[model samples]
Target: MSWRPQYRSSKFRHVYGKAATKENCFDGVPITRGVQDNNFCAVNPRFLAVVTECAGGGAFLVLSVHHTGKVDPHHPRVSGHRGNVLDVKWNPFDDYCIASCSEDATVKVWEIPPHGLLKNMTVALKELQGHSRRVGLIEWHPTAKNILFSTAYDYKVMIWNLDCPEQVIKNPVRTISHHTDVVLSMSFNVDASLMATTCKDRKIRLLEPRSGTLLQEANCKTHKASKVLILDNVNKLLTSGTSRWNDRQIALWDLDDLSVPLLEENLDGSSGFLFPFYDPDTHMLYLAGKGDGNIRYYEISSEKPYIHYLTEYRSNLPQKGMGVMPKRGLDVSSCEVFRFYKLVTIKALIEPLSMIVPRRSESYQEDIYPMTAGNKAALTADEWLTGIDRGPVLMSLKPGHPTGESDGECEKDQAYIRDRLIAKNGGKTDSNGVAGNGGTTVSNGQDFLLCSPPKTENELRVKFYKQQDEIRRLVDLLHQRDVRIKQLELEINNMKNSQQNSLEHF
Candidate 1:
C-alpha cells in the first residue's frame, strides 16, 4: 500500500519520523536525512514483507507480522549497488524473495534466511548484470516465477530467467533495442503477452512478449525533457513532465495512428510533472503532480475524449518529512501512487433476490381496476428463477386469485402469467405511470392470476449455507496443506541442523 499521509498535517510527523542518526557516509559526504520522492514501493498481501528504497544507495527489505508493524531492521540489507536504489519489487507468489534495481545499472534478486548474516535475515541470492547504464525500473512477470523484466538508461530492455541460478546472468531470454534516448518507464499488459515502454525520444513502443517484435509505436509529441512515459495499454499511452516551453500537459496517444493523439487534454493546474495512473477495471485515469501536491482523478472515455477532474487531494504542509533534505531547492517529490493488492476480511456473501427477478411493474396496466404501485408489484418469471422478489411478489399473487394453488402449479402459473403480462402490457411503463402503449385494458372480468414465484429467502439461505459448508471444507484442506508444508520445512531445517551438529561432533 502507498503510505501517504492524509494531509501535510502533523499526523504525518507522528507516523514517519526523521532519521535519528547517519550510519554510512557516501563519498565522504554525510547523507543528509529527509523525505525522498514518493516512489513506488511493493508490499506483500499478508503485509509481512515490505520492499522500499533507501536514501543512500541501496534498498531495504523489512519483514514484519501484520498485526504488529515491527520491522526486523537487522534483516539483511541488500547493498552492493553504487548509486541510489530506484525501485524494489517483491515476487507475487514467494514472500521470501525480492528484486531490486538501482542507478548503478544492475538488478539483483535476494533470498531471505539463506544468504543473510542473521538466521532470519535477507541476502542477495543472485546478481543480474546486463544493462550498462542506470537501471530505472524492474518488474516481476505477472504470471510466471523466476522471470523478470528491467528497463535502463542504456536504451535497452532485458527479460531474465531467475529460476536457473546456474544460467549465465549475461544471457537474457530476450533483448530489444528501439528507443533513441533513455527508456524512462515500462509496464506489462494485464497478460504477460505484451510489453510497453516509454522513452525520452517522444515515442512509446509496444512489443510482443514471446517474440521481441515491435508491434506499434505512438508519438507523444512531447519534448526531449519528458520525465516519465507510461503505456496505458496495448493501444493507448500516457506521458507527463515539465514541457520544454509550454505548461505541463498529460498527453494521451492512440497507437493505431501516431500522427494525431486521440486526446491531448492539458492539465493547466499542475506546474510540475503529472503522474498518471490508469485502472484497467474502471478505465479511469488518476493524475498527480509534485508542484501542486494535489492528486486529481479523471475518467477516460473514448466517446467524450475529455478529462474530467473527479476529485483532488492536497496537503497543508510541505511534503518534506523531518531530517530529509530536499534536493536542488525542490520540495520533496510527491509520492507516486502505484497499484497493489491488499487482503481484506472476507464478508459473508448475501445473495440478493431482487437482481434475479425481472421487473414487471413497468409493464403493468395503469388503467386496470386495481393497479399495483411501489414495491408491491408482482414479480416476473425471470425474477422467480433468479430468486428475486420472493416475499412480496409471491404474497401479492394470491390477492388477485380466490384460491391458492399447489406450489408447483403456482410456480408454473406465475411463469405463464408473467410472459402473458409482458406481451399484453406491450412491455412498457414510464416512471410516473405514463403508459407507453397509449391505453391500458383487461380482456375480461375473469380474475387475473398474477402469481410471482415463492420468496427466495429460503433459497438464498440455503445457498449461503452451502457456501459456508464449502468454505469449511476448503479450510480443512488448507489446514492439511499447511501441515504438510510445515512438515517439509521442519525436515529441511532438521537436516541442516543435523549436519551442523555432525560437524561439531567430529
Candidate 2:
C-alpha cells in the first residue's frame, strides 16, 4: 500500500500567473538578436536593463522601472562594449551597481546614476580584462560584496575581487579549476562556497569555488546528453536537456551522490533549449524554452517525487529569453511571489508576468512570504576571500519592517498624514464621521482611519499622490547612500596610502 496521499496538497497549487497589459509592457525596444543561450534581460527593484540591437559597439539600455511603455528613442544607454553584450547581472547588494560580460573579451562593472541615465554613458566604473576570448557569463557572489565570477570562451572561470575605489582589475585574483570545454552555465550555493557548472562537454562538475577543487563529478546517461543544469536550495541539482529519443527531459540529483539521478522525467519533443530558473525561497522551479510560449512550474521537495508539477503559464507569443526578479523586488502587497520579464523578439516587447497567490484580505499574506534575502550583503569581499561563510541577511516582506533601512521615514509619513487630518478637521470627531465641510469627520488622535476608507475619489487621489511622493523620497535617500559610500571608500584609500608612506619615512 502507498503511504502518501493520492493528490498532493500545497498552498501554492492555486497560484496563478498574471500578465501585465500592453500599457504596462515595455515597448519599442530592439531587443538583442544575439545567438547566446543566456537571458539578455536583467531587472532589479528600481531599474531594468535589456541588451538592445545596436549599429556600433554593443550597448544595453537601462530604464527606471517606472519608465515603462514605449521607450524614448533617444534614451541614454551604457555603450562601451566593443562587441555584443552577452550577459548582464545586477549587484545583489547595491541596486545601482551592475556587471556585464561581452564578446570583446572583457568584463565591465557600471554604477547607474541616481535618477538613471540622462546621456550616453561611455565611461565604465570598473573594467576587468583577462579573458583571451569573449566573456559570456557573469554572476555576482550571493552573500559577498564585490566578488564576481566570469566564464569565457577560454574555458576558464575567473574570480574577481572588486573592492577598489575606481580602478580596473587587470586580471582575476585566480581562476577556478579550468573546464575542459565551454562552460554552458554556472550557479553557486547559498553561501557561495561551492559552484556547480554545466559545460559543453556534457558534464556537470561541482567545485569549491575559492580553492578550485573539484569535490564531485557526475558522468551518467543523463550527464552525457544534458545541456543545462543548476544547483537548487535543497542541496540538489536540477538539469533540463534532451534525452536519447530526442524528447525534452529533466532530472534531479543529490549533491552528495550524483552517480544516479533520484528522479527523471521526459516531456514533449522540442528543439529549443530549456532554461531552468529556480526560486530557492518558494522551492519552485520554472522551465521556459527559448521558442515556446508556455512556462511550466514545479514544486521541489526533499521527499519522494522530489519535483511536483505546479501549472503552466501559456501565451500566444514565444519568448526569446526571460529574466526573473529577485525576491526582494517582488510586490508583497499584491501577494506576488515571482515575476518574470519575458522577451518577445518578434514584437520587440518585454512582458512582465507576475505569479500571485490569491488572497481574500488586502493585508500582508505571511503564509506565502517568509523572511527573504535583503539588499545588504552578509560578507565582504575580503571576508569571503578568506573562506568565511555566512548566510544572507533575512528581511520581512511586511511594510515598514526596517530591513536595514530607517523606519523613521515611514513614521514621518504617518506624522504628516496625522497633521493633515488634524488641520483639515477643526476639532475631534469619531470613527463614524470626520469634521469636514459637510463631508466626513475624523478622530483627533487617529493618524488614519481604517474603518472609514477614503470616502471621496478626490481624497483617494490625494492619498495616491502623497504615497508617490514618499516613494520618490525613499528612492532619493537610497541613491544618496550609494554616493556616500563611494566618497567614503575614496577617503579611506587615500588615508591608508598616506599612513603607509609616513611609516616608511619614519
Best by lDDT: 2
Deviation in Å, model 2, residue 278 alpha carbon: 1.4
Q: Backbone collision count in every prediction?
A: 11, 5
Best model per TM-score:
2
Give candidate 1's TM-score.
Answer: 0.51
- For each candidate in turn, the TM-score is 0.51, 0.80
Alpha-carbon RMSD of each model: 22.9, 13.9
- Residue-level lDDT tens digits of model 1 in 251-327: 66564555565555566744555555564423445565643434565555454444445545443322111011101
Give the per-residue Cα lDDT of candidate 1 at 172: 76
Residue 360 lDDT in candidate 1: 36
Tens digit of per-residue lDDT, candidate 2, span 338-364: 999999999989999999988888888
